[model samples]
Target: MNEIETAPSGEWQDVAARDQLDPDFPLGVEVNGQPIGLYLLGDQVHAIEDVCPHAEALLSQGFVENGVVECPLHGAQFDIATGKCLVEIGERDVRCFPVRVVDGRVSIKIVPV
Candidate 1:
């Protein structure tokens, strides 16, 4: 399993390797002790909160169509790029993080809400 965990003192946390991630699937990782979903499209990577705000489902297990990820629990759709709740099932927006690739590894900058 990927070993992404809480970063110390709100620092950027190294989550996973670029080579280990599947471009079509969202990987669930932890950043600053919070669950985050990671997605790769072409050379770009995006990060969002992993849990669906509408229900108790992991966004990583959800389906990504176009730029939106549909929540598996209730079919709520969330935009991967901006973490917007496109379907409006929930008023809450998923927290998005700034991602970086350094030396073939992926790191995420956690921003507190």
Candidate 2:
């Protein structure tokens, strides 16, 4: 289990340790019970909804290259840093979460629907 810390605004929740993340891969984690995809590009970590907006594929399960996550179902690519659908196969854009690194922990800001 990981320790969770809430932010002053009660939105950002600590989800995982920075050391636990793989720089070469994307990690799937739950923040406030919502599935999220965590990607480590260079020294920065980006957070987006785990489910691809275009299909039923998990972004964490797809191939990640150059800060872009490619959907395995249709080859549509999304920019993890902005959650923008780079190659639009449909009118779908992934939701992005605000990410922060505090004291070696990865914190994600999750807004309830």
Candidate 3:
């Protein structure tokens, strides 16, 4: 697999390859000790924080509809592409990361501070 970028902390790790992912299901990747949600919508891959801000639920376990991922526990909605919380129940925004496919290999650029 090809690496798009290293973590800000300079740690070496491999999340997953492009072919290993299921486009229809949410994939979980841990980079720099952070859990990231990886999903494929259409022909592009998106990465966001896996944890729901309103609760301890995993966003990856939530439902994805019309580009919005709804929290399974409290029914909070968030735009997966932008990580913006869509409902008033959860005002906190989820973190987003840059995802890129290089040479048929998928790699996500870890969000840095």
Candidate 4:
């Protein structure tokens, strides 16, 4: 695990090491006190809000398959790369943060949704 770095709003903050992410699993992290999920798809990484809109469950803890994450609480699914809600139970699309990797560190720029 990597230590999360704090930064001002709208600025990129280091959340984890690039190697810490797994395609089969999502990493849950906090940036600016907001929950975010980090997912790896092929060679790219994506950051999205971790909380499920329908049940407030952590999406990072959900089952991930075919680039979709299913809510552990209510079976809602979301597209990992786009943060779009795939299942009706998801309620609405989640917020996505801009991500970048440098020196094996994963950083994300968080903005208010």
Candidate 5:
């Protein structure tokens, strides 16, 4: 008998249409097996890593209050827009990704700088 293997699909699928994501609630989507936090702030969609750097916690699982994600583990806060760690004093920031919505589709660019 012979077996075949398949490659993983590309990331950034059209998880939600433009009409599905309301301006009031942020939408959470998984791309390439990674949790991506999506928020529509000021006519633009922002995507960030859903994991809190301080601990092994999912930011999406936490509460999204006032443009900041409060880490349910240690109560650390992170700025979703810039992926900046609010609790940490130094330049410890969470990973941020570029997001784009075209033709009523949402996509994420995870290219590192």
Candidate 6:
């Protein structure tokens, strides 16, 4: 499980430790009641909406490969780094949050940066 901390709106909130992220697996977290998925690509961390727009599945539970994540339920695919829908079944693109790492901790800003 990933650690979670709440913060005021537009502020960066600590979500997990940098060591908790895996290149092949995404971490699911909820910030201010919004489900978000955390992905690690190389040394960079990305944060995006977790829910599949075409269905009610968590994107974090999907299969990840080569910067893309495929919805486990309906086969919808999205770019993990850009949150862009890559498949027709995805319906639309998802929201992306800004991520920052400091002192071995992973933090994200839900508001547009």
lDDT of 5 by residue, 51-79 (tens): 67776677766667777877777787888
Query: Which of 3 and 6 is the better model by lDDT?
Result: 6
**Per-candidate local distance difference test:** 0.82, 0.79, 0.75, 0.90, 0.67, 0.90
Give the candidate order by descending lDDT: 6, 4, 1, 2, 3, 5
List, residue by residue over 1-113, the lDDT tens digit for candidate 2: 23244444447787888998886678887655567888898899898988776666777878888888888788888888988888867247788888899999988887655
TM-score quality measure for candidate 5: 0.72
Off by over 4 Å in 5: 1-13, 22-25, 89-91
- The per-prediction tally of clashing pairs is 0, 0, 0, 0, 0, 0
TM-score to native of every candidate shown: 0.90, 0.84, 0.82, 0.94, 0.72, 0.94
Q: Write the per-residue lDDT of candidate 1 for residues 1-113, one digit (tens) a residue.
A: 24465667456788988886776788887655678888987788998888888776888888887888889888888888999888878558888889999999988888665
Candidate 5 shows a clash count of 0
Q: Mark the 10 consecutive residues where model 5 has the least summed lDDT.
A: 1-10
Candidate 3 lowest-lDDT run of ten: 1-10
Better of 5 and 6 by lDDT: 6
- TM-score, cand. 3: 0.82
Candidate 3 stretches with Cα past 4 Å from truth are 1-13
Q: Please provide, for model 4 over 1-113, each residue's C-alpha lDDT reduced to its tens digit, 9 standing for 90 to 100.
A: 22366788888898898999999989999877788999999999999999899979999999999899999998999998899999998999999999999999999998766
The residue-by-residue lDDT of candidate 3 on 2-53, one tens digit each, is 2233456533335677776665578776676677788777787888988888
Q: Over 4 Å off in model 1, which ranges?
A: 1-3
Stretches of candidate 6 off by over 4 Å are 1-3
Per-residue CA lDDT of model 6 for 47-113, tens digit only, reads 9999899977999999999999999999999998899999999999999998999999999987853
Model 6, residue 22: what's the lDDT? 93
